[model samples]
Every structure is written in structure tokens, then in C-alpha cells.
Target: MGLDFSVVPEYAHFLWIGVVWTTVLTVSAALLAFFGGILFAMIVLYAPRLLAWPTRFFVWLFMGTPLLLQLYLIYFGLSQVGIDVPALVAGIVGLGLHFAVYNADVIRAGIVAVDPGQNEGARSLGLSRAQSFRYVIIPQAVRSVTPPLGNNLIALLKDSALVSVLGVAELVHASQLAISETYRPFEFYITAAALYYLLNLLLEAGLRAVERKVEATR
Candidate 1:
């Protein structure tokens, strides 16, 4: 039938629940990713060679793997080892961990983008390397990285849907459930797509604002 509204009057309610869970997952994962990325980038930049290389390797491994596979490993694979991480935790951690690798690389490049002249100038003024980095280099690098960082956060928001496989009840999963129960796939899916578009629109607008603030500081 054409646009079967009566077939699934409850679809809106189910989708609302999905939207809430999706928002929760997206926000939680973004926070973890941001902090983990900063930590990983710092280690890659400043740690001893031995420590740095291994940390770099870890970043590389996570970045190279598919987020879906990582989620499976954390959710199902861990259970095989008796680790039993909660699905919500696994989803957020998996998404955040994956995003952190890419974010770390972006942040590292931002740090490198800072001029050698700035470091040398600070040295000439008798600032130690650590002092120069803290007082001079990092703040500038962080500002430079903000735009790419926001982009990664948007990616994180969309990718959070992958966690649905673990039964995390996010937006996609909710839509799927509604489709099965009501047999109105087109309508439910179109609604889900609209919700995602709205989410992304809000995210992009917010990022643009943050990007402007960061740029203004420079």
C-alpha cells in the first residue's frame, strides 16, 4: 500500500527511543575518543622512543582495522575469553578507540605543523623543551587541530550505528525492529534517514561554530 500510516502508528514512539539511545552512544563515544586521542597523540609525540613506537603501533592497528570487526572482537570475542564487557560499553569503547587512532594521527600532524622556529625561539629564550611545548607549542597545535577534530566527532556520531549488532538499541536497530514488527520498511527507513540527516545537520552547525572560535583565537 502507498505510505501505510495506519500499519505502524507506533513507529514514531519506537524511533524516538532509538533516537535517544543513538544520542547517548554518540555523545559518550565522542568524549572517550577526544580524551583518548589527546593522550595517544601526546604519547606519540613526547614519550621515549621505545614507548612511543609501541603506542604508535597500537594506534596503527586500531586505525587499520574495520570498526565493525573491532566491535565484534570486543563484544563477542571478549566473551569467549570470559571478559564479558557490557554491550553499551563495548560499543562506545570500540567506536571511541577506533576514532581515537585517526584523531591521534590528525593531532600529531597538527603538532608537527607548528613551526620549528617557534620551538627554537623558545629555546633561545632559555625555555626547556617541555616548557616550550607546554607554554608555546601545544596550545597552538590544539587550535589548529580543532576543525579536523570536529569532523572526526561527526564521523563518530554516524558510525555509532554499527553498535546495533551488539543489541545496543541505537537508532538503526530501532528502525530495523520497527520494520520487522510493522512490515513497513520504506516508511521506517525513510524516517530513520531523516533523523540521521537532522543529527548530522546539527553536528555540522555546531562544529562550524567551534571551528570559528578556534580560528578566532589564532
Candidate 2:
């Protein structure tokens, strides 16, 4: 069949809905992962061995598995056990939890990249360890950690497509529905790809701006 985009207008609303959900899911998951990662990294770095071991295992569990499977466990598996969750909630939580491990590693590395002498200097100034970590260490780590965090944000954006499996109506799902109705897979799929590319361009631009601002402070 000849390439045809005539059906696009009829399903533009579908794609738009997909765009909205993709943005919402990415932002929510990114926030959860970023902050959750900070907490997890702290536990890994400072907690007693007993606590740290289990936290590490939790991170490993999430990181090692397929995220789509994680979504199934959270959305379908939990419901089977009498804990019902909406698809949107499941999508956000699954993506957040899965990525938080990588963020933990990124953050942990960033924290350690701050010189040991800096920590000792903060302590010699009579700052408590916690105060030093909060005031001196974290600020320095933030500058080093930002680029990797931005890269992960892009991965998170692309992976948001997986949420369609949970029936969350993200970009892929919308494209699938349009393809089913119109039998024009190329047109819809290419449109979806183009939309994702545009979103990535915007995200990359934002990341660049952030990196420039962070660099200005150094």
C-alpha cells in the first residue's frame, strides 16, 4: 500500500493524549527516581551493614529485571494479591523504582568524587559529619552528578513507552490503537517516533541549559 497520512487528522486526538500521558509519566517518575535515589544512596553509604545489605539487594532486584516485568508485578501481580492500583500509579512507581538504582550508583559516585580532604576540612571546622555531607559534600556532588542524571532522564523518557503495556495510554499505545483502527502502521508509528524525537530534543536542550548554569557556579 502507498504511504498515506490522510488518517492522521482523524487520530490526532489519540496522539495528543499519548503525548500528555508520556510527559506526565516521565516527569513523575523522574522526580520519584531522583529523590528516591538520594535516599537510597545515603542508606547505602552510611547505614549499618545490616540495613545497607538489604537496601543494596532491593536496588539489585529492581535493576536486574526487565522494567516491563516490574510493571506487571506491580500492576497485575499486586492486584492478584488484593492490592489494587491504577495503571498510572503502577507505571510511575515501576519506572521510578527501576531507575532509582542507577541513580543511586550515579549519586554515590558523585559524592565520593568530592575529595576526602574536603570532608576532613569540614570536620576540622567543627561541622558534624551529617552537616558536612549536607552542606559541603552534596553541593559539590550535584555539579558532577548532573550530566549522568540528565542522560538517565532521556532514557526514562524513552522507557516511558513501556508503560503502554499497563494500559496507561502512552505514545506507543496510542499509536497501536491508531494502527489497529486505520491499518496504517507506518504513518502512525513514524508520527509517534517523530513526536518522541521532538520531546528528546526539548529535553536535551533543557539539560544543556542546566549544565551551563551548573558550570557557571564552578
Candidate 3:
């Protein structure tokens, strides 16, 4: 039989909604992971021994496990214990937390890449420790941080597909629905692949633009 794409219009809405859910998952989780990572990195770098070990344990726990397993524990394991989390919330939390550990490590490396003397110099100039970090250290760290951070975000975007296993109705799920009904796996799957690729390209472009803008300021 010759290939036909007439069925695409019939499922356009499904694809559109899938795109939206995928975006929501990626954006929400990215923000959570990014900001949460900063705090975690700070704790690792500066927190007293009383608090730092526990934070390290948290990071280690997430870092050592597979993300899919983490999502299962959050979404299904919790429900087994009578604490039901909605699908969207589960995806966001699972992806956010799993990636946060990795981001924290990347951010910590970036922060540490700055010379120790700069930090001591800032303190010597009479700026409070927090102010010195906020003004001088972080800005300098951004130069080192942006590339790896962008890579993490790109990886996160691809990982969003894994959430469909939890029935989040993202692109892969939508493609599955189309395949089931129309028995046109190639068309739908190809479409989904194309969408993912295009999104990755756009994201890379955006990250590059950001990197260039940051460079301009340097």
C-alpha cells in the first residue's frame, strides 16, 4: 500500500495538545531543577557540617538512580501508600528532582571554577559574604555555567518523553494513540520524531543566543 498522510488532520488536535503538555513538563521541571540546584549547590559548598551531609545524601540518592525509577516511585509508589499525586505534578516533581542533583553538580563546578582569591578579595573589600557571592562570584560563574546548563536543559527536553509512560498525554502518548487507531505507525512516529528534533534545534538556537548575549556583556 502506498503511504498516505490524510490521517494527520484527524489527529492534529492530539498532536497539538501533546506539544503543550510536553512544553509544560519541560518548562516547569526546568525551572524547578535550575533554582533548586542553586540552593543545593550552595549547601554543598558553604553549609555547615550539620546540614551539608544530608543535602549531599539527597543529591546522591537522586544522582545514583534512574529517572524512570524515580518517577515510578513518586507517581505509583506514593499512591500505593495512599498519597496520590496527580500525573502532571508527579512528572514535574520527578523530572525536577532527578535533574536537580545533576544541575547542582554542574553549578557547583562552575562556582568553584572561579579563583578562591576573588572570593577572599571580595570579603576583604568589605562586602558581606552573601553580597560578594551574589554580585561577583555568580556573575563570573555564569560564563562557565551556561554551556553545561544548556546541555542539561537539552537533555531534560528529551527526557520529557519518558513521562508519557505515566500517561501524561505528551507527544509519545499522542503518537501511540494515533498509531492504535490508524495503524500508521510510521507517519505518526515520524511526525513525533520530527517535532522533537525541531524543538531541540530551536532550543539549541535559543541557548546559543543566550550564550552570545552573555558573551557580549563580558
Please report the candidate that would top TM-score against the real structure: 2
Name the candidate that leads on lDDT.
Answer: 2
Candidates' C-alpha lDDT: 0.89, 0.94, 0.92
For candidate 2, give the lDDT of residue 217.
Answer: 94
Q: Write candidate 3's Cα lDDT for 86-194 as tens digits.
A: 9999999999998889989998998999998988999999999999999888778867789898999999999999999999999999999988999998889889999
Better of 2 and 3 by TM-score: 2
Which segments of candidate 3 are over 4 A away from where they belong?
A: 124-126
lDDT score for candidate 2 against the true structure: 0.94
Candidate 2 C-alpha lDDT tens digits along 24-109: 99999999999888889989998999999999999999888999899999999999999999999999999998888899999999
lDDT of 3: 0.92
Model 2 bad stretches (over 4 Å) = 121-128
Residue 182's C-alpha lDDT in candidate 1? 81
Query: So what's the TM-score on candidate 3?
Result: 0.93
